[model samples]
Target chain A: MSGTVLTRTALGAVGVALGLYGAWLTLSRQTTAQIVSTVQYLVGGVVLNDVLIAAAALVVGVLVTRGLPAVVRAPVVVGAVVLGSTTLLAVPVLLSYGRKPDNLTLLDRDFVGGWWVFAGVVVACVAVAVVVRVRRGAGGSEPA
Target chain B: MTSTLPTQLPGPTPEHFTSRLRSPAVAARVGLWLGLSFGVCFLTGLLSHYAQNTSQPIPFPTSPSWGYRVTQGLHVITGTAAVPLLLVKLWTVYPRLFERPPSLRVRQLLVTGLERVSILALVASSIFMLVSGLTNTASWYVWHFGFRAAHYGVAWVAIGSLLVHIAVKLPVIREALLGDVDDTHSHDRATAVDQGVMSRRALLRTTWLASGTAVVLTAGATVPWLRTVSVFGIRSGDGPQGIPVNRTARAAGLGDDELGDSWRLTVTNGDQSVSLSRADLAGMTQRTETLPIACVEGWSANGDWTGVRMSDVLALVGADPESDVTVSSIQQNGPYYTVNTLQKNFTGDDRTLLALRLNGKELDPDHGYPCRLIAPNRPGVLQTKWLGSIEVQA
Candidate 1:
């Protein structure tokens, strides 16, 4: 085998070994019930993101930009993605799902307000980009 | 090149993905940073896990008091940054889902199968780690499984699969990375054209900005100066004392009775034992050290902890200054954090104190009243609040 192939095989072997060891550790350390729940979470995360989330994003990307002028398409899509991701990150805190009445320090931030401000900023930036593109008379001819 | 394979699948095929931004060049660029983030996160996470382990084959260091602070902070920051990069990477490669195998050869089928499995593991485990880790910052427990063990175990899987992925795609990655972002000669689909408003370079720039914004909005919990803009930070460096509390006395179910005048901290060696009351401890030589209460959840705050040195307390039972001591808490609720072993490195350090006061005032109940262990370069969980006893290992 060539040097490149040799290196690749070595890396693959080590990776496989490490991955198997991790799977074994996960199985051995957790209880049957815990393992079941963990597997559910692991599999569910893949399905949720790959199927639901990605599909929704695809739909929204196609639908939202279908009729829109090309000048604002990129900014709008980028803004939506940024806004969606940030909102997802802030959801746990915003919902205060884990807020303990006894512990005021946890999830004490005004996340909802913060998220709104962040969303507004993203929207304003997108709007600015669109306006600038329009002003430049580069009606989808130039790449942003 | 036309494939002989049937294209009767109902779903959208690779040809349907025509965006020039979704090329291998974009994936490779974003993936490079994503891989770096995961690499940093994985290493720091391992360090953190090892630090918190009950038995350390090699003792975790007590020097550089800000070591854990930097590491845990990097862990969260890198993990947060990976969120955007991962999303972008997935989007770039999503078209490959519909691509059919070029041939039905056995070797090709096996390679494809292995690649798909590794990718599945990588994607699933990566998502699990990030999502679970984010929820953990808020102390949210949506699942019944133990978070630490599951997170740690899955981290190994994620990193390993990522390594395999890198190995598998090294050739393509090298070619794409070496070339310009706009050069889509061989890496992009033949159907892909520059029809979108954004170029590949612009998309990458936008992704980086989004990632930076994510980090800026959340990293304030660890980087004290960023607290104002870290509006999404779980803790605002606010608590009863000058620092934030993870598990409050009330949350720990410790009533005033346990923390009342009857509290006595017992110090013990193998055959020797010494008990001291709050007043007795107060009369001892007091030392104060400003140390950051860095938590594994990645929030940290510094406080001037005034109390007797662990060395002095260990000396009461004729224990050596370098003795490893197990600090137990009066906390009855939590099982794991109720007891933490302080290595000889921590015990021998004059900076390590059984803190009686914070910021010149007595510690509030929420901040481990009576006395709590405050050691340098240790996770806040191992600080062992609400003192019960300290057992010196022979």
Candidate 2:
């Protein structure tokens, strides 16, 4: 059976998280300064997409790989890689939200470096998917 | 030990996932599109910087009045839309980033390593640029002016890496895009998604639509739309320059009108050349306007510019509106900044002129000094400063 759209369960988690974050930012009654601060945080996180742009990629990768045989699920694999990478990026923000801001995240000074490591991982995953697909094709008669 | 059957999914395990950098087609496509868009923004921004800081002029559209505004507005809008496009493009091509270096080859490893590093730089700096830019837009002042410096600095990194990306992947990009839109289509049965959903097609459509939406939203905000859905309303506030922050006036910085130079402007016309000094020119029709000087960065400010009508200057110089007039700068920097007839310059009203004052006072250094060109609804870039010469480009 085609494994398309079969991976919605995990994706649903991310979607829910994104929506919740967005809603919280929207509904919170903040002073102008507080609003500015929140907006700054939001903008800072979002603008990262211009370079690392991992969030949308993760979503698309998930959509692309949602269906496919296990042997060639390039999109789904890509999605997982991007998702994991972005999760690392979200760590600082979550830490900040949790009121336990760890200054060591280096988000302000080396944000691009941090985010790009995730992007780099995604690229690596795509290659792995290809190799696995090819090996599976070569070993057609071997295992059940 | 009674163990349940392993619930491992059939086929390749996650650990065996190969790299995408191996897929030259995907790598090349990602590299090219990303590089081009970044290049366009980088170049335009560089150009604007020069124009803003110096009195030199570039051959910008000068007619229809509102031309400069449209172009600069477009530049900002495009930059904003790039946020989403960059993300989506990276998502699609990110997989190729992981392909192993050419095994057993030193030369290939260096080449591949360089490419990977450049890609990394491009991704890293672009994220910095977008985040900083958006935060600034939102007035999220976490950092100091250092953020501005960082933005410019990262821009160079992004541009350099993007160029490398283009140099390496240009040929592949050309080939892939050579075919019609349908060529990008994939119909392989191995990767089909759900029944009514064509994934690749949907992706492309979504990308284009998102870009178009950005364009529309920006234009709507700038071009005076029947509706208003400007993202965050960056231009929603009012000051002289839409400088929403730093409102407290400085000590001893009396507003402009207090200076009261009643500056005179002189106008002269000769063959292919026109000269104007502050005195003879101001003798002509003097106009005062309180208009916001909107910038491409989505910032706006209201300044009172008092000056003679440029049309009258053109008339004295035998430069007719029927023909294009080239306005040049007095300061030694440049003479190329001139205006031509654009659609917006004709604001169905008479609000366009070369402004000479701000807030009832003579122009300041940070603002344009001596004199500068001003038109309604046009972007700040087109308003050239330091009055020098005007030539009718026949």
Candidate 3:
């Protein structure tokens, strides 16, 4: 066998072994409810990324690129991605805001307002890009 | 796009969704960023694992109060950045999932199967690590399992699968990255090159920007100055002494009476055990150091801690400075109620303290009221809040 193939196969075997060991450890140590939840979250994550996030990116990437002028597409799509991901990361905090019973110190921030401001900033940037693109004409000076 | 070429071999071409954006050129480029991000995260995570490990062959560092803070910070930051990069990388290579083998022979079938399985494992484990890590940083316990153990285990799986993925694709990566990113090559036949609204260069730049934005938005928990801009930042460093508390004494089931005047800190080695009252500890020489209490949950704060030096206390009890000291907590009934072992370096560090005060004021009840073990380059969890006693391990 070639060096690359041998190395790849060996590494692949190691990965599979380690993954199985991790799965076993998680299954063995955790309670049944915990195991169920772990599986649930694992599947949920895959679906979230592959189906929801990837599909959204694809649809938006296609839609904006097809509909909008060449100059504004990149910035608008990039800004939307940043805005969406930041919002996704902020969701848990926003939902559980001010809910810490023992210590209000944790998650005490006004995350809802913070997210709103973040969205406003992203929208403003996109609007600025749109204006610049329209003023500069269809293909004027690619987005920096 | 040419449908047939010398390298195409003798078989029907596999039909699938084709996009110029999903070229090998894009995959190799984005894969580099994704790989680097995961590498940094894994290495830093291992450092964190070693620092928190009970068994120490060589003592972890005791200087650089911000060592754990920076490393654990990078751990979360790199992982967060990978979220966007991973998405782009996967999107660029998603068509490969549906590509069929040219032949049904044993070698071809075996190769295709192995490659597909490895890809699946790599993607699955990466998603698991990123998602679970995000939840952990947010301190949202969506699962009942132990986060540390599962996270550690999955880290190995992710790294291993990543190595396999790299090894298998090194040649393609080398070829694609060797020339201009827009270089049309033999592999271009699989994709219809489209000079669309967004050029190839534009897409790459946007991907990089997205990743950078992700890091900047969430890194405030670690980078102090970015606290204002990091709107999605979990911790704003706004608490007692600009520190955040994970578990309070009341939550740990330790009432005010437990931490009242009767509380005593006991130090023991073999046959020699010394118990000192709160006033007794206060009468001893007090040293102050500004150290950040960095938690594994990813929030940290610098505090002016005043207390008796750990080395002094160990010396007073005639405990060997070269040995390990187990610091026990008053929260003796909970999961975190277990003992935290201090290695020789930590025991000998004069800066290590059984802290009684923070920022010139008594420690808040939530900040480990009576006394808390404070050491350099240690996770807040292992700092052993609500101190009870210290025993020199054999």
Docking class of 3: acceptable
Q: Residues B312-365, candidate 3: write the lDDT tens digits.
A: 888887876666888888885767435778888888888899899999999988
Let me know the TM-score candidate 1 reaches against the reference structure.
0.97
- Measured with C-alpha atoms, the lDDT of residue B245 in candidate 3 is 88
Task: Tell me what TM-score chain B of candidate 2 gets against the true chain B.
Answer: 0.56
Kindly give the stretch of ten consecutive residues in candidate 3 chain B with the minimal lDDT sum. Answer: B1-10
User: Which is superior by DockQ, 1 or 2?
Assistant: 1
The candidates, ranked best first by TM-score, are 1, 3, 2
Question: For each model in turn, which proportion of the native inter-chain contacts is also found?
Answer: 0.65, 0.01, 0.44
Candidate 3 backbone collisions, by pair: none
DockQ list for all candidates = 0.73, 0.03, 0.47
Q: What digit string (tens of lDDT, one per residue) describes model 1 on residues B1-394?
A: 2345536547788988888878999999999999999999999999999999878889999989989999999998999888888988998999988777666677877788889999999999999999899888888888877888899998999989988998999999999999888886877899888456577777888889889888999999989899999878888888886677778888888888999999989999998998888899999999989999999999988889999999998888889999888889987768787988888988999999999999999999999889989999998889888999999876
Go through the candidates in order and give each one's C-alpha lDDT: 0.87, 0.47, 0.79
For each candidate, give its TM-score against the true structure: 0.97, 0.48, 0.91
Q: Give interface RMSD for all predictions.
A: 1.2, 19.5, 2.5
Cα lDDT tens digits for candidate 2, B302-344: 5667876666666665655433445554334232333323232
**Worst 10-residue lDDT window, candidate 2 chain B:** B243-252
